[model samples]
Target: MWQKSPNHQSLSEEEESKALKKAPSLRFRFILAGVLVIGIIASLAINLIFDYSQKLADLSYDRLLRSALLQMDENVGLIRNEVSIDIPWSAFATLAQAEEDRVFYKVESLEQGFITGYQDLNSFPPNPPVLDQIQFYDQMFSGEMVRFAWVQRYITDPETAQTVRIILGQTRLSREEMAAAVTQKAVEVVVLIALVAITLIIIGSHLVLRPLHRIERALEERVMGDLTPIDINTPKETHHLKVAINHFMARLQANLEQLENYTADAAHQLRTPLASLRALAENARDIGYSNSASPEKQHQALESIVQQCDTLSQTVTLLLNQAVVSHRLQTHRLELMDLLVPITASCREQALTALRQGVHLSLECELKESLILGDSFSIQQMMQNLIENAVRYSQQDQDAPAEVIVQVMEFDLFYRIKVIDYGEGIPESEKERVFERFYRGRYDVAGTGVGLSMVRDIVNHHSARVNILNTEPKGTTFQVDFAKHRFDGDNQ
Candidate 1:
């Protein structure tokens, strides 16, 4: 028993991965998106870092204010039972050590009322038992945004205990100066880094994309019919692309050869018909007046010439169609379309011709909604050739009418189209050769003998199969199976 190979089914991702690994990689030029993303992220990071640095500088200065306020906390005490106090000069010295900043202090005793300091500076409430707690906030002092710190302490006289809050506030000249200096430094560093990144992106982009530019120039400077494989050895990333281009050039060369053969064949095949037409024409022109039937003979000669011309035109058309099918097999794209739409239209178009030949042509489909993916023109060409062959070859007899049936049937995993003709059936031995170009059956029928050949090419290009089967006892059937042709990405 013959068995099909298991590897003929769908592709595995592992195989695709291996194939991609073997092929030359086409790397993306990351200069554009990479630079944009990096620039945005770096800008945000620099701003965050600089802003945090400013807050950190202000926080360190807040510690200084807390220190001076602690000193005031220790200074407030009940002396001689009068709840008196003296301000420390060193505390003021610490607060006064600012570049272009004015400092203020206030000391208030909960029991001693005011201890000879700015009383309005005690406007903010301290956060509970400020024994070891130092609170900082922003406030308005002398019509400017000032940073303030609050502290509280308890002092005992061995008999009476009293508590007071020490609050100190300062104008924000020193903190502003610190923030400006740090941000300026940060800006300079960011600018430098940006310049370095931009330079690297420029140089890297030129280095990476240089191979593509070279390939472009090679294509541009190429002469006519120059399909030589490009020898680009640098930039390993574009290696696969170069190889693909070379393969395409080779295919193009083959197509050009096919076209040349088509032209040569066309000229060679028309020679016999054209020579016969010319001989008949010359004979008609020289038909002597010695016979009374010369006029009738001339008319018959003109009719024969017409028939030969039709045969030549059909031969040329089929050859042209064959060439087009060959070219499209390489470069055509598959499209999603309805199979019934074009099928019905083609049958309608050929109905009159079939009628003229004493043939009854009809179409039938098992499914009403049939979807197929293919190139419409190529599929149409294949269908037209098959059905027209059936129409032309259907047996005409005195006993019964000639009939050609076109049927589309749905199977488990594929679609089948059969063009069945109740004609003198094709013999089993000659069936295979009928698809070869310019090869006809043993019967002396008028045909260009290239229709079935073009059909074979079209079917193979679509990855489908066509089989010839002897139908019943006296007819022939051409069956084509259009299997599922799915790309890997389309499934995903």
Candidate 2:
């Protein structure tokens, strides 16, 4: 016969208690979300600023080119004559040098052809001729892309009836350079705006999140088991969440108070009945007429009284344990292995009794020695109750070989303990009620109805879980799962 090894890594009650204390609160997540939203908005604003600045630079460059074209048009008449034009280059030079020095001027007549300064410098005629006003064109000049502004003026020679079209055009390198400079300056301004926007976002986010931080600090300073409403003066944006949290805390505080009262009241009520039954049993044993009254009858009465007393005692114990488990469930660390050993030991006597009644009792432990953080005592009590219930419900008739099987296995993040009995299984309808306190099945059996309920309370205390499955071939199985615990020592 192989002795099953206990789950060594099971969390003790103390460990399960510690875990509930470490869960993060909602306010911390809220602050992180707010910061993320601000960061996204800042990024979008920076892109928009850069785009708007580029548009402004293009508009300003077009305006400057038009103004330079108008100045050349006003001076064209003074420099043009039929067949013998004496164009003073100084007038175009003055206009070119005034605003942008990278300008190149040219004068052309259909009859005279290219006949002025900068005309041989790769100049091209403007498209969509400007009859009386300036037209802007982008063209390649001297192997360099340039913007040009030009106008064509038709002048009739007063003495000769011949018409001369004077074309005046200026290369726009200076305008292009000024536009580039303006665009650079706009980029610097947009960068400064983006920096300022980011700074404002950071500062505003901090101010907005300040109230949440206050609420968080208030919650952090609170003592364990303290479910007081958080007192915080917050913006309207946060009021709904604050109110919801406060309401939940208020209800929790009330529930805890009621549970405390129930435990105290139940303990006080059950103690006197147990004491009286013990006293009556003691007196019956001391009375000297035992053989005269029939020893068997006397013994039977005494045994009945003792059994009732035990039932009462167990009830009170279960209730008190439930109270303690509930409190610890609010804050506890649990180890599954630590819980299994004691539960198995506690149920050994019960198992042996079942075996004597022709029922086989076998427990198979297959879980790895995994650690968990939880309420060990509650976990053990849960296991004890489950195993005891299985044994109690198992059929003892010799015709059918009744059996109770307990198995422990591990899955990801949970340690599973299953207690299976081959007896009259629970009906589907009664399965849910089995875990309710003081609820018993209609089957005729001696039970206080608190065992399964106590098991549930213990499982809940560690924030663990439980399930019941109706096994095939007329039997029932109870499965309890405690949260898995990792071993840090080996890694260290």
Candidate 3:
């Protein structure tokens, strides 16, 4: 017994691992797809949240500026027919609570000079506001961005009333701080949700792909020679893969069994012929050593040895031919061809051999082309075997030359090949047994009995049929029929 070295085994294992790593992983792809989807949604949400937060901050702060202006308007009164106003210091107190920001207010008469408050705070609306309506606008003042509110008041002092305008401006420090705080809080929430979604995606992908992992482990743990079908649960989507793998294993198992049987049969068939050759050689050696041996006895022993060698050679040749046919049938694919080509070639190749044996081998084809789907090599071997078998048995008598004719004809639905031999026809009871491996009906005939068996194998591989029929009066005919339209290229 031999065992593989550890280093070689480890090398092979490493190679397998490399191959698996190179393969595209479904789990990784699934997770990547999920991550991409989540990323796109998160980006859109962050952008929208930023806009919403800024709008909310502006709405909350603008109300404070408007309230301060309204309180100042109530203080303007018409005293002595002239505009008089009492400045309210409490209005500034309300605006200072939100943030440390600069406040500027201006109270003035449109027709008169400044009344009270900052004279340089000129930020105002282009048009006077409607009565009881406060207008808000933004402008750059004193090198700082400010929010301003404007309102109009008609005050009478009993001498002459003047139109009073009150304006209030505040810097934007508080509004920016509030907007940043709100946006930060929203981003934190979005980050938490994104993390949770990514976690769930990883877990779900693992759960979905668990069945495939189980299948891999099952295959990896099996013995090298195991050919049994896998018996594990799988989802509906993966069922076809399991079925195909099992089918391939079953085919491999069948081929292995066939190889074992063929080996045993070949050994059994070679044993008898090899033993006879050894015995004849020993007898020839003994005859040469005998002191009283005659020339006739010595020649007879040599002749018998030569005859056994020929038989052994024929047996080995037939066995080899059978092996080649079997191997080719498994490996070769069939193609559209004309059956008459191989038949004519076989007749031509075997013509000299047949004439030497006092048998005339001839070919007769009535049709110009008899097409069938077949492997050319196997078909040629089949024809050669059939023609040789016919010639071997066609010698009826030594006085007249025996006739063996190979005929190719196209019938209504199939192509037929007939090998006719005018010799002692097979008995009805032994016609079927004649095709069995190594089964010889007549010991006097010089053959290995494997030729007809190989012919039958080739016929079956082509999905054709073969039959042995007795010719009228005294002869045997081997007929083979091939379906004309089974694999026709024209029909396809």
Candidate 4:
């Protein structure tokens, strides 16, 4: 008993289709997008923090100025109208010293409207009572820049409707100091927030992209020839990557299988012809020495020797053609007409040989002009093999005629060449096997069994298709269809 080979099992068309549907990998793209989003958010947050800090500083400074103005108002209201009440420096000084040591106070008398308290008091601007609204103003006093809050009060004598203005002023050091502190605190907070945000972003990015690192490692560990499916089950966002990798592996496995089959077929076909030549040579040498007496006998032996040599030569030629076509399939440029002309010429010679065998050979070309892109020599060899096979197999029945027909038709997008032979046609079941190397039909014929197989190879190399069909009356037809090519004459 023998175990079946793994390659013997056919791949399901559905599975192959699904493999093609696998999504492409986007791990790097995902990471890049995430980084960009994080950067944008961080930038926006930093700007907001700076704006908020400046607003807070402004609010704190305004509040300090309002508090200073309220203190000055309270002191001025205590002045008596009956007599000029001079305010003690200690009174406003105490209030100013409580918040800021660098305090300045100024008061101008309402009675005489004269400079009072300090000579610097005359430099202070008088406040308007109705203009008690908080406003920031700048002034130069004692040759130094200073900012301050001032308030004005009215003292009315009961007997008179006249009003006297008493002005009180103080230095703005406490409010300025408060504004500075608020600004410094806001700067520290912004710095701390930025640091925290940067740290978190770094950590988040790594966590988000950690799965990609696993995929990379898995890929690196894989062997060059290993086409096994990836084992990792990724997140939904990363599933496309899994699908793409699996698709690539499937194609790789398929190509590898095809390579293996080609290699095996080549070995099997070449081995027998080589062995036959070797045996024939050895036998010829033996006969040469054993029967040296008869010249006629020697001549017969020489003819046999020549026939064997011819067989070997044909085999080598077919092999070389197959190899050349396989190579040209990868890298070659050929015009359609160039390939067809040579193939037709080669097959005409084979058709002439068939005529001696009592088989009629006919050519029917429906198109005046046709062209394709392929390897010319391979196409020639393919045509020769098809014609030879037809000649060999066309049954010679005295009652019925034997004939081989070659037809070429050109359609809008393709050119089709068919070789039809009227012989014992192939059974439907065996049609596919005719293209396998070394596979022969039930009919007895002198053949290397590689003729039709070579035809199939050459057609495949040109990215074309071959159809084997039975004609209406009798015999089988091998149809070769060449796909259309887009070409600019200059490029060719």
- Writing each residue's lDDT as its tens digit, candidate 4 over 27-72 gives 4455566566656766676667556655564455445555654654
In the range 239-344, model 2's lDDT, one tens digit per residue, is 9879999998887877778677666657665775678687777767765355576676677778768777777767677677766766666666554456556656
Clash pairs, model 1 backbone: none
What's the C-alpha lDDT at position 38 in model 2? 53
| Model 3: worst 10 consecutive residues (lDDT sum) | 392-401
Q: Compute each candidate's TM-score over C-alphas.
A: 0.78, 0.48, 0.67, 0.56
Order the candidates by TM-score, highest first: 1, 3, 4, 2
State the displacement of the C-alpha of residue 233, model 3, in Å, after optimal TM-score superposition.
Answer: 3.1
The whole-model C-alpha lDDT of candidate 1 against the native structure comes to 0.78
Q: Best candidate per TM-score, number?
A: 1
Local accuracy of candidate 3 as per-residue lDDT tens digits, 393-423: 8875454349898888787789889999888
Query: Quick one: best lDDT, which candidate?
Result: 3
Query: Which segments of candidate 1 are over 4 A away from where they belong?
Result: 1-42, 125-129, 234-251, 286-300, 320-369, 374-380, 391-403, 408-415, 422-424, 483-492
**For model 1, what is the alpha-carbon lDDT of residue 175?**
87
The lDDT of each candidate is 0.78, 0.66, 0.85, 0.66
Which has the better TM-score: candidate 2, or candidate 3?
3
Q: For model 4, which pairs clash?
A: 336-372
